[model samples]
Target chain A: MAGTVPLSRRNILTDRRRLVISVLGVAVSIGLILLLEGLWGGLRVQVSSYEENVGANLFVGEKGVRNFLGEVSAFDSSAVDELRRRPEVKAAWPVNTRFIVLDFHDRKQAAVLVGSVPGGMGGPWKIAEGRPVEADDEVVIDRALARQHGVGLGETFEILGRRFRVVGLSSGTRAWMLGYMFVSHDASAGLLRSPGTASFILVDSEDPAATARAVREELGLQPLSPDTVAENDRRLFAGIFGGPLNLMVIIAFAAGTLIIALAVYSMTVERLREYGIVKAMGARRGRIFRIMLGQTTALAALGFVVGFGFYLAASALITYALPQFWSHVSPAVVAGVALAAGLMGFIAAFVPARRVSRLDPASVYRG
Target chain B: MDDVAIRAERLEKVFGEGDVQVRAVRGIDLEVVRGQVALIMGPSGSGKTTLLSMLGAMLRPTSGKVELDGVDLARLPESRLPDFRATRFGFVFQDFNLLSSLSALENVQFALNLAGTTGRKSRERAEALLRGFGLGHRLSFRPEKLSGGEKQRVAISRALANEPSVILADEPTANLDSKIGHEIARLLRNAATEEGRSVVIVSHDTRLKDIADRVLWLEDGEFREINEMAVDPVCGMAVERKPETPHYQYEGQTYYFCSPEDRDEFAAEPTKFIPDRG
Candidate 1:
């Protein structure tokens, strides 16, 4: 043709179903990749909900326990009063986290129940619907989990065989893909069956390092700065999901490559004779090769766009349907997936282009 | 100007190796001059197409020299051969070999485009050629929608689009009916005489002979010209019998020569000679 676009594109477009199938194959692979990455970002955000939003500067935990991943640490809850006695401490509050399953309306959902002082230092900053934890049997739930569990204000559910009322709803309080339920120290202490124990203590001291050393030496509990706690939480999630995330990325790369390779290769085979004819007509091997690669490049690019579109739709659905579980779509993440898809397109067409290059011009005579 | 557009000296093409080796074209000596259409006719497996491929630089000769415009095609670099063929030679296949997705005008434009013609120039040149070939009304029609003769005419227009010095056609009239085939042959004849191109047609269809300037009958990897005139082995021209022509005798056979100069050259080195058989 005299046009800029090769006839390969027309041939592919002429068979509308094949073009759509090829585009969809690449789009679905890219969509899956974006979904996994978004979920990973969401996991990081929700897992560090406490340390990120908490106003305290220092945290005191068991000497050997890591940060609050699954909240599997416990210590004497009296550390709060002991830390408060220090002249450098502005205020100190003991915090507790426990993974508990709530039985509601004949269904069970897992939750991470975090308890802090009612109003002093370590509690939810924003409550969307209803009042804060006002009594021993009242709990604050993230709006996302509340919507998911169909429980809102004045709705009561059983936690640890005791009935508790959902009196408040907070936004963005999620951990480990589950909801974070906030309660008073006393109520959570009762839930843990250790009335005076706390998993950690948050201190709002201006000089966090000095206060941390003082708390560590006097109380024998390791006091960590907030940054260290947040970093530890991020690294912890990386350790937990790193292998699976790597595997998913590899699968995404392979799926995209194979889809392009198979599509281009089969098209090349189907038009092998046509390619020979072009060769005989004084077309260089590179010309024919470009036509084949051009097809794959067009397909991959279209697929990438479609995949990105799918991700946008999915992200919107996630935002609307699941408010507590946030799946972030970062620019870097999108660029990385697009680059991978482009690389797959470039590499995938190599074999088929090679086939086109090696085709003998005399083969057209065979027809 | 050089009249000889394509000249082959003992051209040969072999397929495979060892036990399965087959010689497709065996030592055929031929030449087609400008403003002339030379046709090669043979049954299947006669190496007609194989010989055409070597002559057109589409395939490498196993041994021998095929030259186009004094450039030895056998010695041409692989990278330069495509440009050489595109710029210097055109090809027409029997099946019309038009890209089915392209319109008739676009088909001619593709040939011009491959030789680096584009934009308005490409379109204008393609239009002029197709219009000249009486295909002005079918410029936008694709091959599948056109009749066999129309498709072949479009193919001929494509061959002439680049204004190549020579057109190498493989079975140019094999697919058309007798009437359409003759029309295609006449088109080829005009391409050579009116357009002043050298055309080489390889086909099994003898219907092309009425318009052919010279015809070669190929069989068993070798060929003999069907023309009554004899080709001067030294000067590479079909020499007619005349009182002014010189003659040479070798092994009880009388050879009429184009000139005394050619007669002297052949008489000195007869062992290197490749002569036409009766």
Candidate 2:
């Protein structure tokens, strides 16, 4: 008896050009899936950018406020002073935030306008250049947005028909469809025409649980930890974008499986007579199917390697071309794509295996 | 111990059904003892290949049974047929039937692998067989790279990989030139005489008669003795001397043909299509 031939590998490799084409086809689908997944990951990180990165341990919003992006959250500016007087509160900062479209240089940019008290906890956390906003008319905008529009320090942009000078540039402060712009609390209050009130009260306390209890029980406001606020914000965005992203991923997966199935099916059709010969020579159905699956698996594995390479390159190009749209490919994403590739191979095998199973070994004699 | 390697008792094979039915092979009985070479020669639709397929267990007979040694093959379950064929019978085809992707060595080794031989032993057996066939240097050559003769030789090496008790060849010389065809015929004969394996061949190539111990001529899905049949010089098919059978007078003798087309072909080139008996 002889050792088994690597039939699957050899069969696919027999036509080197076809194999390359098939791998590349599968690679494109895989790359698309990886790109979508990475973008989803970046969306998750971006949505929680303010709550995660701001120095506040807890956020005190108006009653019934559960999220930051879609929901309106506001409380009396006097709540900050009262929170500052509490023993559990280490520090309290009144911040007013709202979504506003800034029109400048013949373009409109959607942004989260944050009015943090000068030198307060909710101010620009990561200043890339210049100083944080101090004057009522000064603003700190996200660096990527400024660079995209060629806005620089000392340049003034109008928000809500009021002109404010760009004093500082912040990093990692953009969500999926909007960027963050920081200004003095009075500036946002004056620009939005809401006076003597704050959107949320940022609090850094010695015991966050104690402060949350005090704010909810005594001040009659909703007190949420930064993590809770971030999670709620993420859920809010996920609800908006999850369907489209998942549909794209599913389409990519189906495309990958189709590429693999098409390649294997054609190969099976071409070598059908040889398969009949093999059957006539006493190869069992199990053996024939193993060869088919082996061919598909080998093709998918090659495609995955090429796809990951494609993803890495595409991600770099995207980051360079559109700095705001970040794609993060984590280990979990890689593992998931690899598993999906294997599943594609498994699913692809059946189309051709069915053809082989129906083949008549007696056809070998016909030759 | 039984000396017969394969036995077919009133074996029949039919295709289609009802109005369109075709009786491909009808009530055929055959027995080939170990170390004997049996060559079945026939016209294109004469059921030679059909009978061969049944004998090799590649196709089940519509009726009766095929027995190898003392065991009836029909009694074996469908799942067991593959292993049974792999271990007991070796097949050769007109096309040489080598897997295009496999190298010569791997093609031969695949049979042994199918029969549960693996690793070093399989390699050694495949290597030895290819070497014995004078194909040592061609071990790594794919079928496309090999000449027709080399490919046929490789096919023979593959057939003998598991040292099967019977070797069944279909039109083994159909695609080969005369020189290579004779070489392949000798190989099949050697497998019978030297290795004591029963060799059954189905072919229209009259040259194969030189090596066969018994030659059976089949016509219209049934076997007919060569003495009761006349060979068509143009195509070498056995033609019964019936009233409607086409015949021509050549060199003061009557020659029979399976078709008027063959008769006309012979008439145009009588010397080119010389009857084997004449």
Candidate 3:
């Protein structure tokens, strides 16, 4: 019997063009999967950016607000003091969320408006390259939005027909698909034109979990931890868009498996005579089957390496071309895809291998 | 009595069944000893190849018995026949049947590995055999690159790689020209005479009769005549078989004694017998 590896390599490589096309199929499938996963990763990071950067222990949100980043949750500002009166709460700050159109340097773009108390846990934690927002006419913007509009410190930008000087720049504070423009608490209320209402309350506490429970019971406001809020927002985002992404991944995998199957099955049929000759030389059914499987497995392995390389090249291209369009593929994802390729190869060769096993060695003598 | 290497009794083979049935072989009895070249001569569909397959344990007879060195091949399980073929008999096909994916050396080594010789030793043995057949330069060539004669030589090397005692060839020279065909015939005859193996060739090529020790004529799945021997039984002189003259009988058997004097001497003293008789 022929050694399976050498025979498989020779057969698959006999037609180099065919092997390359099959590898390309696998690469496209895996690259699509990784792209979707990377987008999902970017979204997860975006949704929880504020809670993560605020360093807040507890968030007192409105009753029906789905999330803190994208939802409009307005309640009386008086809840701040009430929450701060609790022993576990060290400090409480009022904050609100609103979508407002901003005009800067004659260029207008819609931006998410965040109203917060400056120098408090509700505002930007640290400046990237500028001073913190101080006066009522001052605003702090994310570095991404600043770079997008070419704005810098001491530059005045209009928000909802009102102008505020850009005093500070913050990094990695952008929300999911929306960047923020932070202002003083009064300025936020002034922008909303709602006198004494805020969207949510940020709190610092000795024990956030215990305070959250107490605040929920005493004030009837859902006091959520940073991690809990981040998780809820991520779940909501997935519910709205994840279904389509998952379907795309599944379709790509199925198409890849089918291509591999057709290619391998045709290969086996073409070599059926050779298989018969080997059998006549006393190769058993299992041995012949292994030879077929060997070719499929080898193709899959080569395809996996090409697929991973494709993913890397695509990721680099995406980063270089679209600086703000984020994507990342973890090592575990690559391993999972490689394993999936191996499984696809095995399944693809099964029917053809069975055909080989049923072949009669006596057919080798036929005319 | 000659030491029998292969004995087939009433071998019968039928293909398909009912209206589509074809009786390929019909109860042909045969025996060929070691160091002898036996040729089954017939046209196509005469069951010569089928009988050869049955004798080599490649095809199970429909209703008959084939014993190789005293083991009833029909009684052996089907699963064991591959090992039997690998270790006990060698087969050469009309098409060469060398695996196209393998080189000549790989083909020969593959056969040796199946017969339980493996590693460097099996490779060396394959190279030695191919080299001995003067195919050393062509050992690395595939079937497509080699000529018809070289392909047959490679097939012959594969057949002999296992060192089996019996070689069953189906039209071994069917693909070669006349000169190459005669050269292949010489190779088969050498396998029997020089290596002391029983060689059986099924072919329509009548030129092989010159080198065959016993020619069995097959027609319509049955033997029309058999044991066309050239060796005289009484005086041990080589003579062509003729129906009349120098023929004698003892007990119930007839003999070709080569000469009238030898026949008369055998008739006068029936007890005195030569030990070296085929």
Candidate 4:
């Protein structure tokens, strides 16, 4: 009797049902892996996009800023002026961030309203519908928030027991804590009942490095770079989203691996007698091992294709529903999923290959 | 001339140690010549299959040497045994063990591929072998689709694909119908005589005796040359004679009764006691 024969593409394609099932299992597994990873990627991008649009060089808060969730920030208003007088500083402005429940047209919604200085970098209030806030009793609303609450330009809304007129509708402005709104410094101070004080100072500098040094020395405030701010937001999002995402990815991988492993294992066991026959015919053990491995890899590759298609459909649905938050599907993530699936197939084929290799050709001949 | 393709020297195979030891092949010596079809005939549990396995290099003898083509199979390393089997020996089974997944042609091609023949040449050779076995139209048919005779022919083609020196068939006709069984016996005999290849068949089927160049009888782990006068009068049983008894002949056929009881029975009713003399 010979050993096992070398695997060929023809052998794998010979059984269409096994091929389809193996591929499907791989696809589902890879798709799930891509989905979880994509969500993680999307959250990172969204946070960075928000921070980049804000144009804030340093955020000076009342310490333990993460605990407040932008509800309140207490710092002396004079710190802005002191930071502005330094040679490295180009301009400085006070910013007050407050989270409030607004009653608009009989609907109540949570919103983050930021108090910005007139003509300041901290303000992202580009008027798309009406105009920027001119009087203390007026405010600006983002497009998404206005649509959700059914409030438009020239409408008045009550926030934190104070009535404010919606003077403008803005684009590309979102508050990190809640949704989106913008108001003038005095109106925000009055609404929060804080007098002559702002939450944090936003600074633009002649040179960011020099300005960073000046703020540290003159104002006793730690300067946060734009990159650092984005990083902070990422960490914050991870704190909230990491556990569920990790759990989903781990479970999906395990299930996919087990499904492929068991399928391949059963198929190999069923083919054991055939393997003995082929081996007795002079097929090498290495060749037999390669054939089984090839089958597994082929199945995994097929599954990855289907899985990526599913991921694309899912991503389209999410992007359509939440257009404001940056959501995207990437090929790298899909490839990663496919790789994971292939690895699972390889692992699953290991034990079966061993069993085939150990089968004696003489047993088949014995009557 | 030492024309032996397979030679066993005092071969021993013990199943277990001490109390449970079953001496399957105990100190038996045999030699099978090239181009000869030797039939090892025995009842059940006679260790004929075990002896064949050792001679075929499928099993290692416990204490003695079995050689094929002057190469000591017992001393051959495990790694080299498969190569030895592939290039020097072929095997056929009673069950016609063809892989169900492959067509008859592919099954034969699989053997060629294992022997390192690949691509167009392998296919061409496999097709030629199948066509020679009268399976030209059934070349693409899987084992399940093929008839018993077809499957057996495919098995024979697979066995001969490597053109080995010897073919060891363990009860090749056991699973076939009488007609198919006779066909298989003829095929084995033809392969041995026409192809000039040594074939060793282990079978208790008396039908195979006609096709065999030599038939060796095995009983209680021992083998003896079966001559014309050693054949039993009833049931075609072959008897080993003691020194006291002489051989007997009747109607141009030789007969040997083991004892006086058997001789007395034969004397009273000779026609009823004797098998067909042919």
DockQ score of each predicted structure, in the order shown: 0.33, 0.74, 0.21, 0.28
Q: What C-alpha root-mean-square deviation, in Å, does candidate 1 show against the real structure?
A: 10.3
**Which number leads on DockQ?**
2
RMSD of each: 10.3, 2.2, 11.0, 6.8
Question: Which digits, one per residue and each the tens of the lDDT, describe model 1 over residues B60-154?
Answer: 99999998889998998998888987788888887888887788998888888888988788889999988987899999997899998999899
Which should have the higher TM-score, number 2 or number 4?
2
Per-candidate TM equals: 0.86, 0.96, 0.79, 0.80
Model 3 TM-score, all chains together? 0.79
Give the CAPRI class of candidate 2: medium
Q: List the residue pairs that clash in candidate 2.
A: A1-B117, A1-B122, A2-B112, A2-B122
Looking at model 1, the pairs that clash are none
How high is the lDDT of residue B199 in model 4?
A: 95
Name the candidate that leads on lDDT.
2
Clashes of each: 0, 4, 0, 9
Fnat per candidate, as a fraction, reads: 0.47, 0.90, 0.26, 0.39
User: What is candidate 3's lDDT per residue for B26-47, written digit by digit as tens?
Assistant: 9989988998999887645678
Question: Which whole-number lDDT from 0 to 100 does residue B212 have in model 2?
Answer: 96
* Chain B: TM-scores of all predictions: 0.79, 0.89, 0.79, 0.81
Which rank order by lDDT, best down to worst?
A: 2, 1, 3, 4
Sum up the clashes in candidate 3. 0
Backbone clashes counted, model 1:
0
Better of 2 and 4 by lDDT: 2
- At residue A196, candidate 3 shows an lDDT of 93
